[model samples]
Target: MTQAQPSATPEFRRVAQRLRDDVTGGVYAPGQRLPAAAELAERLGTNRSVTERAVRLAAAEGLLTTRKGSGAFVARILKRIPRRAAALLGVPEGSEADGTREAVEAELRDMGLASRYFPTMSTERAPQDLAGLLGVKRSGKNVLVWETRVFAVPIGAQPTDPGTPVELIRTYLPLDIAAGTTLEQTDVTPLDIRGRLAELGHRPTEFTETIEVRPPLDDEAQFLGLDTDNRVVQLTHSTTAGDRTVEISVSVFPAHLWSFSYRWTAS
Candidate 1:
């Protein structure tokens, strides 16, 4: 049974529960489109807003899918990705067992899934929290940003399958640190960012990471083919060598598709 959700009204909950029951009871088969908005509203005896709210909640639960122009449908259950074991996502970035961003790509490849990465570079004014984390003043500090999206193409699917986006990565580097390196070049992506930092005398010896559950940001949700009702796993990873922090990365993954396990020692 689904518990009452935060900020959801009694009528909204009632409608959502009915929809969930209908789907589970086989009244609506998997991958089947739901009735029109007016039909659903009339059936539920509620406004279209209430029906939409219910659909959103169901989508978050992984029982329904809401697509633009196509409307909501019963979600077709797919094989689930196993939980990921992590140490700095544990033990820092890159190494296979550490569950670095690359580890996920590796896993997908092993499972016969193919992906293409689209990368872009730009600069953005540092927000207060991130600015402080980078040891810079938000008032004037700007960071070089690299955003990469990994789109998953299904086996034997057409180029225009509109392959799903499985991962979104954003890396931030201080301007002074990136001034003369490949990090500043949008077209030349470094296979190992930490490795490059080492050549500049900044070998990362320690890293800090934080993981939390939350709703996806608007753009994030859209890219991940999700709605506001979905929960997403967000990780903020920072690396440092001795006294200076060298790099920071923020990664977002679909909560339904990824799980993270962390291990650490007590100080």
Candidate 2:
């Protein structure tokens, strides 16, 4: 009787796992080119198609990267877990004005990493949804939109490879509140939005964040250097000072490079 053929699923997984082990165990160094699919199949005793699937699976896991016209190569995985920053949420009590941003930069500095910020400001009418959230009539009154790009510098990196683009932040505030205030500046503010609002007699009382996971848009993918298979974490932040919504911000972070943690009393 003919022997039953082994299922391709298990074979594929086995090949992928073996390659993953090799990569993780330093058999293949970071940025090192992986064996060709045909060669890998011959060595692993699997067919070329199964080996190719295995490589693709590894790439999806962020363990490898495939370039068009070039074969798969090991990815340079950042091993350190990034420090959690509440900047996306708001400033904390007893912290300095721009404490949120400072805190994040400090943490990166501590880890021998560097950071750069690019800030831009513009005046635009609030979108329908944002206007509703801010309790403003959709009558085309302009709002201040401030965008900042946060980049993380790798240690010993050259100017040509200065750093990795980490996060994109966009903050929105009603024009009446932002006009004539530091919030309208195109430069980094000495304080965060909430702090600046407090300076204007608006005491920030609460903030609510809504987080969603979805595929990255084309622009986001390009800016973050994310592979086509990767997704991103998009967060919408709303801060209220008593009865008024003082600020609304949206931040996008690469899923592979960030995580969030929260602490609260069990009251």
Candidate 3:
């Protein structure tokens, strides 16, 4: 990989920064072969391990591409998104309609990405981590945890363009229904979740959300119809009743294709 001289920072950090700057600055032109690790270490006056770590970090940040035997090369710079286009995911002022999930899903089908649902917590089989999240022992009582993945036709060959399908998930419950059945059916929506909780004699008091940006996991990529190399945006949400946490969910959006946008202004 292209090597850069270390700065005053820590050895590994300095080396990583220099490499990032060089790649981003186009000094190491896209697709250009970088020096081999050992040669790069020699050029940077660092050890091989340090050089390797720096290169790995750069690769993870989408700055460099590494081929199995061909070695590493500068990654092509992605086109810079204009502010207007980047705002597509955001909900404009008063533009969101209540009870729009079905409509949205239909549109997604038109785009070629279809949506599917699975439970995070299930009556038949529940993962151990999910058991803990539900505040039960590994083999304790089960609860409903719903997950949904949406797939859309690519705007292009690469999974990094507008109109890509991603997944939005909600892991709430049917309240006191004794969770024997998984909600595999597509008929459930936010209102359905509320209705089920109500039928169980529980109130859907409040819902909260936490947003984050991160890369997609392997399964996430598969569900979103993306390559494993694609990045995703993640948002975690939870619902509660009377100060008790009842449900949690994580939604993943393909970074190059979809984004989440919400707008608020001074009232």
Candidate 4:
């Protein structure tokens, strides 16, 4: 296809990048079946084994999916969605326009894809590691944990994918601020937690987030419909009010399905 690449790059990696880039570059559409292995190898000036390895490599990164009977196809998922860094100087009254992350559903709708949220709630204590991150004391009846699976469909998708979730949101909150509230029992959203916390006099003055990428855990892999080999983006977020940390959330995004963007403003 393109001109020869640097030989320093492994042949397989170069082939893999070309396959991934071609998908993103629209040479192959999402859910579109790729040409046969022989054809692909011929186009790339390689043999079938190298082409197969490249496909597997790209699939592990979530760029494509392979079927036993059917051929490899570009992943039947949203390949591009902006995951902007959040800036929460203060919780806005009625909207999240204060530079904080916008809702995923809104982002999908803007991109013209239908989306849904499936949530599960729980009452629990923060683990030692998470307790340290949240800066919350573990003693007493004070931890609330919940997770939501966000599902969205790409336009003109195929039967291979239906109601598949691209991301999972898990959150932890100190019960002291939300002790006797709906958030304690019902499925709640990140923004909803922010609004409720602000109502209880815990408006955020600063937010902190860190990202890591690795292979998905067993359950995470199954729940998000990803192959165990796929890379996943883990986002750890915290909201602080003055000196108090009221909320912490970790979002798991399948790397094959989404990409993130960051913005900075001079203060």
Counted clashes in each candidate structure: 5, 0, 9, 0
**Residue 131 in model 2: shift from native, Å?**
1.7
Ranking by lDDT, best first? 4, 2, 1, 3
The runs of at least 3 residues in candidate 3 whose Cα sits more than 4 Å from the true structure, single-residue gaps closed, are 1-121, 124-133, 153-165, 168-191, 265-267
| Per-model lDDT | 0.73, 0.73, 0.55, 0.75
Clashing pairs in 1: 86-89, 86-90, 87-90, 87-91, 88-91
Candidate 1 on 98-185: residue-level lDDT in tens? Answer: 5455665676666666667788887777656777777665765478788888677656768776666667888888777877787776
| RMSD over all Cα atoms, model 4 | 5.1
Instruction: Please list the residue runs of candidate 2 whose C-alpha ends up more than 4 Å from where it truly belongs after superposition.
Output: 1-8, 28-47, 70-73, 80-111, 139-141, 189-191
Q: Which is superior by lDDT, 1 or 3?
A: 1
**How high is each candidate's TM-score?**
0.71, 0.77, 0.47, 0.76
| Predicted model with the maximum lDDT | 4
> How many Å off is the CA of 207 in candidate 4?
1.6
Error of 3 at 234 (Å): 1.9
